[model samples]
Target: MSEKVANTFDGRLIFLMLSILLNVFFNALTVSTNMGSAVWTASAVNLAHLFNLSLGNTLFLEGVIVAIVNLILLGQFDYFRLFRNLIFIVPYSYLLAWFKQLFFAMGIPFLPIGWRFVLDLVGLTGVAVAVSLYQRANVVLHPNDDLPFILRFRFLHGSPCWSQWDSNIPPIAIIVVTAILTHQLFAVNIGTILNFVMQGYIIGWADQHIFPQLHHHLDFKSTLH
Candidate 1:
């Protein structure tokens, strides 16, 4: 690549990698707060419980499955993308384990139920921003989000009778309903509801405002293609 092209490529790589790390970091923080509901976390929780496996292992397995599906659907599963997902997902799972252990070791002391609920909302804000940044980075998305994107790509992006709103419903319904069912297997909380309802607006706002400004600031004019 030309020097200028290489610079842009390096910058995009930095941005995408940083975004993924932040997503995992903030996700850990949200889970530590004992009030938040994330679909992936809930899914991990259920999976771990079902198989009596560690949450970290469950996350890794889920990531593996999701990565393959994403690659197949996007038809861009070159070695680089596969390797990229591999390195990112593997450490991400282990880091999750470490963070959760640290938090628990610090003593997840009792908070009032009300306080826990508030923390969930506070943590949700972090979760929203992290997810928004990662989505805008246009990198390999977490499986949890990628599935929804694939659904929209397949169903909503093409159908004439279905408007954006109509296309929007199914993916949201699929993930959220799956979360609810999984949580019911072992959890019930308003935090999950908050995650379900608030995400669309957050993502919309980020795409319109945060993403454009960020891309402009970074001068990100290229994709990884």
Candidate 2:
């Protein structure tokens, strides 16, 4: 590759790594507060409970399915994208687990409800910031995040709110089904509600404010070949 392309690649890689850390950390913070989690995360937890599986394993399974769905959304196969999406979840799951443990050890879970609520909002905002960073970077992404990214730019006229709300449908179904089967719900709380309602708008704001110059780098047609 030319020097310019190599530099661009390095820059995106840095963004990808930073975004991954921020995503994991904030997600762990939200869950630690026990206020709720992202809908997809809540669904994964519910499924984990229903099937007696680990959350990490459940997340991996969910990601692989979503990655395949992304291919369908693209209307063609891009093996590299699929592979990268799948690979992303493996480390993501482990890192999330680690961060949650670390946060729990830090007494985040034992905080009073009032403080936890504040942290929950902060955590959600951080998640949105991280998501916007990597999505604009156009490198590898967690399949769940990629789903919304695809919807945002590809089908929703670049409306992050609409795409995020649309992306919630599948996980909402999963959560509902898991509730019916298990007679219980996991991680569906105030934070989950906030995430469902506010996350998209937060992402839109972050796009403009967090890294203003980091424009989206992906081209729809170019990736197909």
Each model's lDDT? 0.58, 0.86
Residue 82 Cα positional deviation in candidate 1, in Å, after optimal superposition: 3.7
lDDT of 2 at 42: 86
Per-prediction TM-score to the true structure, in the order listed: 0.71, 0.92
Error of 1 at 222 (Å): 6.4
Best by TM-score: 2
User: Residue 149 in candidate 1 has what lDDT?
Assistant: 51
How many Å off is the CA of 2 in candidate 2? 20
All predictions: root-mean-square deviation over Cα? 5.8, 3.2
